[model samples]
Target: MEYIYASLLLHAAKKDINEDALKNVLSAAGIEVDEVRLKAVAAALKEVNIDEVLKSAATAPVAVAAVPA
Candidate 1:
């Protein structure tokens, strides 16, 4: 998947999303995208199902909160 698409998917997942962070991640991945394009990509992502993307991203390891005594 394109970096922007992946970023948008991550954003849709509501995982503390940020455009600049997405842009940086994409840049690190060797994908160069302009802000205008990024906005368009974000807009396009709004049509996608957020839950599915979140479920997919959830496959990765994450830290869960511990219950307090």
Candidate 2:
């Protein structure tokens, strides 16, 4: 979603991820901003360590199914 991308952009840029920041990103991208969703995303990531999460996700094993003959 655009919201998540915007948040990631903010995080990657070392900028604070809050409602105002999210609003600016969304507006600049010409995407309509939703107040409730913005608040929700900010709150959800408030205490999250994105780098750790990404690391763990990257190291996690992937399940691959065998191809049928």
Candidate 3:
């Protein structure tokens, strides 16, 4: 979702993921910010460790299916 991506952008930029900051980022991207979603995102990520989640996601294995030759 755009909201999640916006938060990721903020995390990558080393910026705080607060409602105001998220709103600014979304506005810059020309996406309308939803007040409810913004509040939910800020609350959801309040105690998350972005770095840890990224590391786990990066190292997580993907299932690839082989096609018949």
Best-matching candidate per TM-score: 3
Query: How do all models score by TM-score?
Result: 0.46, 0.83, 0.86
* Per-model CA lDDT versus the true structure: 0.67, 0.92, 0.92
The 10 consecutive residues of candidate 2 with the worst lDDT sum are 58-67
Better of 1 and 2 by TM-score: 2
Per-residue lDDT for 1-69 in model 3, tens only? 898899999998999999999999999999988899999999999888888998998888966768779
RMSD (Å) per prediction: 10.1, 2.7, 2.5
Query: Cα lDDT of model 1 overall?
Result: 0.67
| Clashing pairs for predicted structure model 2, backbone only | none
Where is model 3 poorest over a 10-residue stretch in terms of lDDT? 59-68
| Model 3: residue 14 alpha-carbon error in angstroms | 0.6
